[model samples]
Target: MLQRSPKDDTGDFLFHFSSIKIYNEHTLVAAPMGSGVYVRHKEGDWEGLRQGMPEDVHVNRLIIQTGKLFACTNKGLFEFDMICELWRDTGLVIGCYQLREAGGQLWAATPYGLWSRTGTGWHKIAYSHVRVYDFLFYPEFIILALEFGIAVYDRLVGVWMEFPFNEAVTGLAVFEGHILGVTENGTLLHGDKQGGFEQIRFPHLFLFSIVTKGSEVYACSDRGLFRISCIRDQITLISVRLGCPVTDIDCNADNLYMATLFQGIQRLEL
Candidate 1:
């Protein structure tokens, strides 16, 4: 990615991985550290959705649901329309956070609250005094990973329950019938679908991003990309020669894409 004028003057690698989302018809959207969301169509790559982004704000999350792509930044949430080839000003907004699509709507874990996005508008489903660092969604509940521990909200019971781990939970992902969480110490939690978490054999490195699909769990920490079993019981290492920190990692049907501090998007055939 050719950068025009850099954002951070001293930060040599001006970009990082902010968000990774898979879209319909096999389209994938990646919001890397620098400027915009790079859209991958089929086996090709393009960075068209990044136009008209806020200059002062950096994209924190990317979500694709119901054929639309969304970018969450410090300024707010912006929606990109695929059919129209432009960004729709639907007034959906959120602060710094992560996002994932579930069921029929999109969920964002913002600093001040948890917001849900449908075709209608943005609505707050939950709010907290402290920031919500990350979240995971299953068929029955939404697991909010916070600075404290884990908060489970039951969709069927209309009740919210929290288990205070008393430590910062940084990353969240799910595979098979298991929920995997990465702590600040890079400790991982493997939980059954019906219950809570139990510590597993996660690496002891500093972690920044994680994603899981099928039987694979991928994590990006200060070290590099770590591949684990679906249960996080076994781990494998994939070294990255890219100078900057590993930003995010994701895989699709044909390729595994990784974004580094400012290396744009690196694609490897699966």
Candidate 2:
């Protein structure tokens, strides 16, 4: 959700929003690529939430866990202190790409590897040398989208199983017991936990993010937004072009929100 700051009357616009999230039912928070984080209430102007953060920090992702806002940024992992109205650095100073909560624990994907936060501090769990992009929990397994392929950690066995892929994966989602992943080159993949992934053809190129809502899966790309439907063994793609490059997308029960590369945030009514 990039735009001119509320105080900027010069008509200059900011671009390249990386992530967006609907928070607390009435607030919308967005992370611009290099401008830290911003928040906006319903129909209100966007406000910066950059206190205690470095100037021009790159925020890659945002997540709400335990009713608190956490940001994955170039500097480190930050938790927003509502009382102080500032972001508190959690002391994990690596470049974090994504954040997730599974089994009541907080996890972060980074260039170094996959890390989990404990009551003590952050610990590198696995893939110490590989870059992790995204992750999701499936039953007792933790599925990760890594630079080379998908890796599933069998919690019961305490070992990691690798599923080799040709392209680097950027995002992942689960739908109806199947794992769906979008590659950096715009390829959509579907497979089970056993690592048998097959490409699902779609027209969009340069996919940036993937998300799921109810029974539907949505992927945002340079072309626009696409809705994927999986019924029985048939897969369907429905395109809803917004005339701009959509970098990220999320949805709730009443609306769908999109963060475009240059067009700020777009909202679609449900």
User: Which clashing pairs does model 1 show?
Assistant: 15-261, 16-33
Q: Write the per-residue lDDT of candidate 2 for residues 1-270, one digit (tens) a residue.
A: 334466555553355677888888888899877888888888778888989988778888888787889998888889999899999988788988888787778889999889998998899988879999998877788889999988888889888888877778878888678888888778888884455888866654667778776677887878888787766676666786657888777678888888888778888888
lDDT of 1 by residue, 185-253 (tens): 667766765666786544456667676667776777665576755324543445543345566766668
Model 1 lowest lDDT segment of ten: 1-10
In angstroms, the error of model 1 at 159 is 3.0
TM-score of 1: 0.74
Q: Lowest-lDDT window of 10 residues in candidate 2?
A: 1-10
Q: With candidate 2 superimposed using the best TM-score fit, by how many Å does residue 161's alpha carbon deviate from the native?
A: 1.9
> Where in model 2 is the C-alpha error above 4 Å?
1-13, 192-194
What does the lDDT read for residue 51 in candidate 2? 91
